[model samples]
Target chain A: MDTYYKPEHLSHFASIAEGNKALAEKFFSYYGAVFADGALSVREKALIALAVAHTVQCPYCIDAYSQECLKNGSDLEQMTEALHVAVAIRGGASLVHGVQMLEHVKKSSM
Target chain B: MGDVPLLPTWGPDVAGPGLPAASPRAVRSLRSRGSELASAETQIETVSRVDLSAMPYAGSFERALRENGWARLEPAPIEIFQINLGKLCNMSCRHCHVDAGPDRSDEVMDPATVEACLAAIDRCGAHTVDLTGGAPELNPSFRTLVDALVSRGKHVIDRCNLTILLTASHRDLPEWFAKRGVELVCSLPHNRRRNTDIQRGDGTFEKSITALRLLNAAGYGKGDPGRRLTLVTNPAGAFLPANQAAMEREWKESLEREHGVTFDRLLALNNMPISRYLEWLEETGNLKRYMELLVTSFNAGTIAGLMCRNTISVSWDGRIFDCDFNQMLELPAVASDGSGFHVWDFDPAVLAARPVVVGRHCFGCTAGAGSSCGGAIES
Candidate 1:
């Protein structure tokens, strides 16, 4: 079976720079700065990245951030809770759309 | 104490209840398993297999030192004389770089060797004596060695596996150590139970907590310099440890809030890739990446503080090494003539002038914040 996602690609992420080096460099530089310790700890940033990875359903991000989270000292319980935050948001996103449908039905009926 | 779980005498088969799915294999030394990695040569070969074509210093530890203007690592007057009593441990933690376990009982230091070590200590001028092993307390002469060191006016440290203090015979060790003013550097992989147990064995966390409570009752972890209780945490898995200061804060808050356990400080260490840990890295297919991580994360700032520069590690039988990791890999500290030196022949001046040994495993020490037996080298 042909697979779209390859585990090895995660390690080869730098290859994305091949097509446009300057832009990729800027993005990477910014990305590195973004994840660094600030008001939010590196561990906290990693946890946020983990939750976002799950929301975006990016396997590369998931793999990268899972290791990153662990490396930054986030435990399994914390990581699992971060994933649930993504799940809740993603679920709420779909459910909130029900309001639009409800408004449409009330206008169309009586 | 009655509610606390008792340590198993041997393997993972007798691990406590509610063991995580990832419980480690039966307690046995790599030597007994006849693993190729049991040989230090094979371990060195494995660590050297990583492709460092793109890495600075070409992933060569010695070359990295040279390139960074450290032509050699020479001892700064010995401050710590670390003794590896033996490998006779009750629990065979998966990430143990020593390959220590109950099966290693035969490897304990004999009385003659202990006497030789004391003689060396007298001449070495080290203010601190660090006793380490599968469990240093398990040694029959542990108290004898401690009393000897104390009488000589040396500060003694016990690199304790917290669970060992909960064992039946060793149960009173907390108070015993407190009485002697011995610093207890206990290993408790995490503040939480799950990660701690996963790396160690089942019920290890509970046993550790129970032991900590005992230590507390004995007046440890109470901000008393005389009763200092230091906790050492290595990453439970392949990753480098978090910032020591940061992790110490978090560990303090969490442990105190949740378990009502207090500790003086935390020492975050990087797990060296050797022995049983090296085996786990290979089996999990993380050997290559973990090695690369160590190489690329190398911080030159950590060179001066490298434990090998100031500490002399004496093996159970009196052989000497730059540090404990080197001792496990059988890399003896050599003399000017390139012959392996022994504790009995220890000459502080000669040892000080000798260049420290380097290998691929040295990268583990220099990685990230840099790790040592004491903790991260850099702030």
Candidate 2:
């Protein structure tokens, strides 16, 4: 109650399905299928999910996937490297947009 | 054999002071610290004291078994005789369930007990003789015992912490074991240095790699049945190990690619909630959560393949237990008349009739993929 985000809220995530069971079940089913091992290992998927979690800035996904990554045999070094991938992409995304400012300045200048 | 060191040095460089100062969690054994938890009774009380009202299955390992239709967990025919040579380890690992360290040198098995163990191994009809300890190689009679077991034509397994193989006295172990065709089941927490060093001491992963390369040079991990080299891994934290087969594939690739090291197989194990690990769980405030996780993740299918069902653990002093964890807690296997059993009194038929002891810590073996000394019980 004191804060906007309660740590316990992560465990209560399934409760969101109570209002729309079918839709929630479908989404969860897709989520489970997505994480299951395939050509990319479960460990790899967990690391990818971890990187995407950071890119999207989802605290719940970050918390869940951090444990997921560790449980799947990814160490802190690998996790940190995965996080840097997110950082580079996010930074690169912003830096690429600098060309817009550059173009506008050149066009507007005398 | 003439050039090999017959006696362990027990020097500061070889024992207690070898731990790197960077590791804050590394400490002397609980026995040396005079901790109440050093007593098995206190450890049992500590495990039971945790509140589990909100947790699934109420965190009772026995009830979890009963609910899963295992009313009385009984043993299969004995196949492996695991001997705990002593508790005098060179390193004080943070997650060690044995509480073994240099301070525990007083607990090593004497020559008389080693002779008794050999006599028991002869009578017990078990095909495999597993030697374990703080570092089994540190025991003075380790080679003598191994030579005896090998002469009996029993499969010998040295449960080695790889760092011991690099020590001054024990450096020739790889070649010695190779000549005898003894299987080396070494502990390497992770292929990566950071995770491996975090659980063990700093510089451990490098030492482990060097040891593995020595093992490779001596014809281990090269797909030979006799000279099999198996690396065991446990998670560095409170979580369970990942899938064993998958982890083995990844380890094979990484250790080979990164270090050019090779191993025949990998056995992923779960950290048990007892001894030094129990101390860490309590210190880190993860005891309740970890116990809950173990109970909730319990897999009923693993019950039939439980190592205690086929393994008899003999302590350094020749006391017998259903498993190594129980041995650490001082829970001796009892005879039908409720008398404590020892290696001197080992009777395979009598042992096969006894029910395996159950405790809250037993959940460590049953959780998720289910862990045993040999590795994952199922899958």
- TM-score per candidate: 0.89, 0.93
RMSD, one per candidate, in order: 7.7, 9.6
Candidate 1's C-alpha runs over 4 A off are A1-34, A99-110, B1-27
lDDT of 1: 0.89
User: Model 2 chain A, poorest ten-residue lDDT window?
Assistant: A1-10
- Native contacts matched by each model: 0.60, 0.90
Candidate whose lDDT is highest: 2
User: For model 2, how does the per-residue alpha-carbon lDDT over B1-379 read when each residue is reduced to its tens digit?
Assistant: 8887777656534544544333434577888899887888889999999988677678888888889898988899889999999999999998888999998889999999999998888788899999999899999999998998889899999999999988898888899999999999999998899889888988899999999999999999999998999999999888999899999999999999999999999999999888888998997788988998988889999999999998999999989999999998888887677877888876778777888888989999999999998899999
Per-candidate DockQ vs. reference: 0.53, 0.75
lDDT of 1 by residue, B1-379 (tens): 8866586554645545644346434546788888898898898888888788778788899999998999988778889999999989988988899999888989898889999999998888899999999898888999999999989989999999988887799888888889989999999998888788878988888999999999999999989999999999998888898788887887888889998999999999998999999998998888888888899999999999999999999999889999999999888888787877787876677787799988989999999999998899999
Best by TM-score: 2
What is the C-alpha lDDT profile of model 2 across A1-110, one tens digit per residue?
58988888999999999999999999999989998879999999999999999998899999999999998889887998999999999999999999999999999998
DockQ measured for candidate 1:
0.53
